[model samples]
Target: MRQKIIAAAIAAAAVVAAPQALASEELNFDAYRQMLADGNPAELFEMEGEELWTTARGPKNATLEKCDLGLGANVVVGAAAQMPRYFADTDKVQDLESRLMHCMDALQGIPSAEIINGSFLKGERAKVAALVAYVVGQSKGKPIQVDLAHPKMKEMYAMGEKTFYYRTGAMDFACSSCHSQDGKRIRATSLPNITTSKGAAEGWGSWPAYRVSNSQFWTMQHRLWDCFRQQRTAEPVFGSDVTIALSTFMAGKGNGHEAVWPGVKR
Candidate 1:
């Protein structure tokens, strides 16, 4: 009976210690990332993206220096911080990737179909990824300030919230399954609980990032596509409304937090 009591005590102690252990591990991982931040390979992509922004290309032979990223023309500085906002020209709420595609089409004469239909990291889509890296790098320390004032933006945010909790597919997983709470992890990666403002900022502001595991820079749109694929649901088209809506929701939730764009991810 004494041995049984001791065993039970030991088990209880272990249960109590588990969360502390996980927290320590997460801190260690953050330190590791900080150590690697100085040499992050995302900088290469940023440089390439900057070049793409300034160089003339496509049928129009125009530089994207004139692209309107919710600021006036040719303004790249800090524009990404307020993105996923309403644009009157398109009569739509556009995220960074979609807005870049718009500029590529309207200003550079690269048809939107090329990006919508092309595979990621290939051809025109690849150019957009580089552009994303560049634009996001420009907004690294800026606050996420997505404006939800417009009726369309409010509508998109609502759709995104609905989509976030709607579960289907073979695994029966909604995004909320993995991201709605704290202390959840998949293998070594700690899942951010995006239901909270801080978590939403971490999840939303850190994307358009370089993934160390895949050796690829993934835009927010690409990340959402992968999320759908992982959920065993039909992946939406690139720049589809659902993707933009999700961006709006997360960005709106993350308003006032600092962006960590062009981030490096494991």
Candidate 2:
């Protein structure tokens, strides 16, 4: 018993000397992420998006400057800060990308089919990505301001709440599976817990960001769709109800968080 106690004492001293061996692994990329953010490539996309908003195209050939984004028509500033709101015209609660799609088709006379069901990060889809960067950039440093009062907005939020925890697909994975826990990681990527307001704000606000890992900017819709794919679930149709619902959920949770997009991420 004396020998065993001595060995235990030696083991304890060794562990004390190397606390890192027992410490939880925390792979922080803050420095590298900051370096990438300082010179975000999304700037280029935002420039392109500005041009798209002002230029005329499609069948009717009208500018999207007349678009109504839940504020007033032609109002670009700070509109993104309050999106995923109820739009009376469409009578639907739409996120930034979905609202943009509506305006492009209505004001620009672009066909809805042209924007929907296209492969991501290519051609028109790529153009849409740039536009997302520009519009969301308008709300930079402003707080997330999703409105929850309207009945429709509340309805969407409820649906979103349900969808967030609805687990399925081959992996039986849900957004909660990844985002409900803190300090969890898959490989080197730290997963933010969106169940909490702080985590949700950080995760939601730092999007429409330039992804260093893939050399592209990802809009909120693209991010959500990709999340589904990663979960081995069916590819969610872009701007579909489920997508919008999930966006509403995240955006609502992130309410009051300052928008800080064009984020740089690996």
Candidate 3:
């Protein structure tokens, strides 16, 4: 009887200890993130982008040097910090990738269809990602300064706020389901309360990141698509208003934080 009771107690203790042991192995995110930051692979994409920016391509056989990024033409330095801003030419708010698409049309005559239709992050889409990296990298260490004064900018921020809290799909989960609260996470990744200014800045400031899991760099567009897919909701089309609006909101929230993108992620 005594032996059986001791065996039962040992079994119960092991069962209780199993989850804690696994949790302990999850690793310190800051430590791992710092380690990954040392020799980031995203730098490769930046190099490719610099070449693409000047290389003659598309039907027009022109480079993007003449393209305007809401700054003066071909001005890259510190331009990305104020992205998703309104463009007078398009009369629309444009993020980095969206603006690049416009440039591809205006300067290179690359049809929007040609640019939009593809497997995610391949061919021209991958080229766009490279472009995003290059442009955002130019703003490295600069404070985010998304302009919200434009009427379109204000509208998009409202829409983005709505979308963040809007819950749908099979799981009926919203962005807030995982992120609005403090110290929430899935597995090892910590979810930030992106609705708040500080959380929003931290959440928004460090994206267009290189994911260690898939060995591919992800743009902000890719990040949202994945989020919707994870929620079992409809995936957003590239450069759509919903995507732009969310990005606008994040960038608005991210304003004042120094850009830390082309960043490493798990």
Candidate 4:
């Protein structure tokens, strides 16, 4: 079925004339995505995440059912949509992955270093990816509601905004270089102007997605890490302040837009 869908999409794309190919290709890609929605591979990760959330593991042999994701403990619904918020317990603004790390340590006695130092889609980091998949799945179609009321959150946002436009690395490329404008494409992928709210939402909300090209699930942290790699900048530590700050900036800008989390990407 998936192959058939892909073939159909390819056939549709092949008929476009050279002058209109780019625009028509994008439309066909959207149609292909819609056709695959019911069978997204992310669902498998979501199931794994749900099991991880409920099962006892780590040193303490306790479950993360009580983990607070910016809402009250054990509240799975709509919680992710409001993340990257200030948590008084830590006295810092944290995104979903960082907060989950805190909960794993506090509630399950899992060391943060295990996840931070691990490779993507391997060992503990793989579990984190699955957990992220499950958590964000619940917030699908919910409005993005990241709050920047706290001083820490505001500071993070400022840092994120600076980071977005700050040019560095060998290529002297900032995130804004690729994403600040409309009608930009890197190969077949459309670059969203994340400086705008709609673009921010499209950029921020549709992450922690499953990449069809690689057949692997990626957390937002992984996404940012890759972005830095592409820009030839120093890769930030996993769940580091800079990554959270960037997340805060995008989430704040994306407020009120619907989340399309656990999204499937080409």
Candidate 5:
């Protein structure tokens, strides 16, 4: 009986120590991230993105250097930080990818259908991702200040809040399921609670990032689509209103946070 008691005490102590072990393991992860940061692979994509922006390839044979990103044509610097904002031309709240499609079609004369219909990591779609990285790099460390004052912006905000809490997947999992809780991780990746300002900034500010696992750049739209896939939910169309609305909600929550667009990720 004394031996049994000793075994039970040992098990209890091990259980009590588990959390500390987990924390140390997590700190080691930070070390890994720091190592990657020394030679971030995103630099390669940034170079490619810059080239894609200047080299003309569409049927019209025009470079995207003249494309207007809300501020004005040829104004590439610091544009990514102000995105997912209302555009007077669309008279709607459009996110970065949708706005890029508009520019690609109108300025470069690329077919909107062709651009929007393609997969994210392939063909012209890949080029779009690269271009996004290049533009977002131009705004690194800028403050995230997406405007939400327009009438359409207000409407999108309301819809986004509703969607954030809406649960309809096979697992009945909404984004809030993983993100609402603090100190949670999935497959060793720390999950930030994006409903609050700090969490939102951490989550939202590091997008248009380069994903090393895929060896490709991911825009916000691509990231959200992949989330839905992981959720076992129906895939949303690229640049759909729901996606853009969610972008507005996240970006708004991240207001005043420093931009780290084109961020490097594992």
Candidate 6:
């Protein structure tokens, strides 16, 4: 028993000394990321998205030019920061992807299934992602300002907060486990604590981004789906209530930060 205790003490000492040992390596790694930021390929997707937004297509042959993003009809610029807010027509708080689905269905007469069935890099779904990129880009440099005033909006906010912290799955990992603390990392990627304003702004602001590994445009919905898959949870239905609720939580947390969409990702 004494020998076992001595071994445990050594193990604890090693963990305590680990960060100091790796500190220099961590600095070098962060510097590498800073270097990559200059020429990120996400700009390609941003350009494609801009074209898709105004270009007309489909059987009925309509562009998304007149699509409403909750501010009013045909208002695209700077609308992203205001999202995850309550919409009277829908009578619920909706996020970027859900709101985009609404516009695609109502304005273009596109079936939601067809859009969801489409690949992230091809077909109607890609177009929606592009539109999001363009719209969110317009809000670049503008402060994030998600509203939670309406009663239903408040309810959704509460639900979202609960969901963010609730842990269940084979891994027993909640979003908070990885993100509740600052300066944690997984596989060299710095995990931001998205529950806080600073972290939320950083994470939420940079979606509709180009992913380096996949070489494809990824919207917020795609980001969330991938997260769940990694968590070993059942995949969320595209733009489902749970996803939107979580988005509401993030967006509300990020209020007052700028929107920087079509962001470059490592």
Tell me, by TM-score, which candidate is best: 4
RMSD of 4: 5.6
What is candidate 1's lDDT per residue for 87-132, written digit by digit as tens?
A: 9999999998999999999988999999999999899998999899
Better of 3 and 4 by lDDT: 4
TM-score of 1: 0.89
How do the residues 97-145 of candidate 6 rate in per-residue lDDT, one tens digit apiece?
Answer: 7787777787778888887666655677777776777778778778889
List clashing residue pairs in candidate 6.
144-256, 144-257
Better of 1 and 3 by lDDT: 1
Instruction: Give the best candidate by lDDT.
Output: 1
Clashes of each: 0, 0, 0, 0, 0, 2
Q: How far is candidate 6 from the true structure (C-alpha RMSD, Å)?
A: 12.6
Better of 2 and 6 by TM-score: 2
lDDT of 3 by residue, 99-207 (tens): 9999998899888777767656688888899898899889888888998998999999999999999999999998889989878778768887897877887777778
For model 5, the local distance difference test gives: 0.77
lDDT of 5 by residue, 101-180 (tens): 87788878888788678888787777787788788888877999888888888888778878878888899988898898
Give stretches of model 6 more than 4 Å off.
Answer: 1-39
What is the lDDT of every predicted structure here? 0.86, 0.80, 0.82, 0.85, 0.77, 0.74
* Candidate 6: count of backbone clashes, pairs at least 3 residues apart or interchain: 2
The residue-by-residue lDDT of candidate 2 on 1-266, one tens digit each, is 64365345434433443344325354766655655454566776787798888988878888888888877987878988888889998988988888888887887777667778787787667777878888887877789888899988898888988999999999999899988998998888889899988888888888878765556678888888889999999878889999888888888998998878767666
- Candidate 2 structure, TM-score to reference: 0.88
Between which residue pairs do clashes occur in model 3? none
Residue 24 in model 5: lDDT? 64
Tens digit of lDDT per residue, candidate 4, span 58-109? Answer: 9999999989887799998998999889999999899999999899999999
Worst 10 residues of 6 by lDDT: 27-36
- In model 1, what lDDT does residue 148 have? 99
